[model samples]
Each structure stands twice: as C-alpha cells, then as structure tokens.
Target: MTTNDNPATRSDRNVERAGKLDTATLSDALDKLGINGQCYKVKARSTDFRLAGRAWTIKYGPAANPPGTVGDYIDDVPEGAVIVLDNGGREDATVWGDILTEIAHRRGIAGTVINGICRDVALCLKLGYPIFSRDHWMRTGKDRVQVEATNIPVNIGEARVQPGDILRGDADGVIVIPHEHEDAVLEAAETIHHAEEAIREACRGGMRLDEARKQFKYHQLQTRGK
Candidate 1:
C-alpha cells in the first residue's frame, strides 16, 4: 500500500492497479507528483488497443560492422511484460513486424511500445495485439539497426523508462510509472478517478458543473503539492 513496499511483493498488484486506470488519469497523477511520463506523439495502433504491464526495456542503435539481428530478443521477454523498444525515434526503418507480433501475442506478452516505427500493421490489428509507436512503415531495419541492449533503461517519447517500470497504454497514449513510484501514482490516479466520477454523478443529479467541480476540488487534483 505504501510506495516503499518491496517491489517483488507489489509488482503484480501494481500492474493490476494500473490496468484499471487510463493513461489520462495516470498522467494527471504524474503531473501532481512532478513526474514526466506522458509519451508524446507515441499512439496506439488502433483506438481499441489497451495494455498494462511491467516494462521490458530494449535499446536499439545502428548496426555494427557485421549488422546483428533486428529482433532476436523476443523469446526472452516474459509474459505480461510490455516490450519498450527505444529506437531513437527513427521512422526510416522498423524494428518490429508480424512475426514478433504473433509470437508476442501467443506468448501472452502484454504489448509493445516503440520509440520508432513498426511494420505489418494488418497482422497486429488482426491478432488484437496492442502496439503503440510513432508510426508504421514497411521498410525493414535489418541492416540499419540492431539491438544494442535489453532490459536496460531507455527513452521512449522523451520519457525515461526503466526495466520493471509500469507501462499503461490506452487509446490516447502510453504512460510510464517508475516502479519506485507506482504506489503513489496509482493511489493518486484512483483518487482522481473517483473524484471525476463523483462530479459526473452530481451533474446527473442536477448539480451545476461548477458546483460539482468545486465540491470535489477538481481543479486542484493535479496541482503539485509543496
């Protein structure tokens, strides 16, 4: 229940808690905590896509002299972990494709968030595999890029993502909640969600919008505290 709880004990619970929250609410919580987690310009492949899980971070860079494999790390990713691929925001080549999507989906992997582009959009859509990325392109990254590292800290949408951090994505976008702050962020998000629901209920009961907002201290919900 506290932020300082052991991560091993809280990881599953935190991921479940994150699943019940939308990115907007989590983003608001991050704002209140003065954390930058909103993944700018990285959007879901389809508005229907949604996922929540611990991050399995990967960083990609230009291929070496021999040009290593583009995606040999997929097999090592654990189930229910969201693969966070940092490709330096490149759009010229894709680091993910249909094969990876099929394998990930079959393996029960939560989803994928790419700081670059992905290919084979149709397969992902068909499999109901969630993919949040800068864009989709057919161009392959085979000879252009290689996996520099795995399970390491990486940047996604200018937001630093560490291995085991919580990643929640919805129609709007993705938000990364640092593992250390998951408890606080989830608690704040729940508070915000409840407050907003209360406002909506009050409106339905004939209370003025302004009155409802004031009653819930809605305007200050996301304000950073001293």
Candidate 2:
C-alpha cells in the first residue's frame, strides 16, 4: 500500500490509498461516481495476483504491409507503472509473453493488463507477476498486430483508460480511476469499505443479516452521488 516518492503527486497519494482496497470496493466507488471504468470480461491470470499503479497505455492495430512489432515499448515503461495493452480484444494473437514478463519483473514494473491475450502463461504464473487480460494464447502478435501508439488512451475490456490513470486489479477484475477523480473515488471507496466492515462486525456479533445490512445502509452502498 506504499508508494515511492520519486514523482509523488496528489494522484499518486490517492493511488496508494486505492491500492489498499479490492476491486469490488473500487468498482462500487466507480458506480457511485458514475464512472465507466469497470473492465468487463477481463480477468487476472490468478486470483492470488494483485496490481495497483499508474497506467502506461499502449494501443495496437493490425500490422501494415511491412508488418509491425508487438512489445518493444516495454523498454520505456517506468518502474512501478502498470503496462496496459489494448489489442482490440483479439484472442488469437498475444502481445505479451515470457520475455516481457522477465524484463518487467526485473525492472520493478508493477504489472501488466491486456485487452487481448498473452503467451508464456506458465512463466508469469511461476514468477508471480500479475497479468490481467481477456484470455491467453500461444500465437505471436508480431505480424498480426502492431503498436499504434503508447501513452495514449486505450480500451481494456470495454474500459477506456488514459495514461497515468490509476489501475487497480485483483481477483475480481481491473478498474481504472481517472487521475482527476482519484481523490473522490478513493474517498468513496474507503467509505464503502468501512461500512461493509461494520456490517461484518455486526453480523459476527449475532445480529441478523437483514438488520446488519440495514444498519449500514448496504442497499444504497453503490448508489450514484448527486
């Protein structure tokens, strides 16, 4: 839940706060805030893997006549940044694989997320590097797909994410918090988390489930704000 002060900013502070929370809580916060950041259909490689960091977005498109490359941008990803690859949800080709995983891990990269698929699943799993994606395959994306842009807005499982946006991922899924709304989202998420904890405490104390929920206003936990 801690972040280095290398380039600390308000968003970074909020990211650290959001990191302590699960995707479910942050997803509820996004709902309450009316932000469409819940990445539907995308999932983590393992439930045990978790990721939280600023996003370094990459957008991909079909290769041209001369063909294009897949993951050459990994060299530019900053330490602790989450590499988000937007491959248009293609499950046939993979933009990530064993080499990228090894290099990213060595560089202290937080994790990676993809709208398409990834190869070398066994290496990522063994290294315990978090990778959230729509699916996984062995096919290379080298000639099939090419990097159109980097540090730009990209789609991940229908969720549009911009560079520097806070990305929180866990067993539930990934959610992006726009830099401008990080403060509000973090605050709202913490409130929801605390309320849920209170409900748990009440239930553990023998209170009826219905009573516990009512006491904490569980029904309105995800209601949008004015």
Q: Quick one: best TM-score, which candidate?
A: 1
| Per-residue alpha-carbon lDDT of candidate 1 for residues 76-117, written as tens digits (9 for 90 to 100) | 777888999999999999999999999999999999999999
List clash counts for every candidate, in order.
Answer: 0, 0
Colliding pairs, model 1: none
Identify the runs in model 1 with alpha carbons over 4 angstroms from their true place: 1-11
- Which one wins on lDDT? 1
Q: lDDT by residue for model 2 over 182-218, one digit each (tens)?
A: 8989999999999999999999999999999999999
RMSD for each model, in Å, please?
Answer: 4.3, 4.3
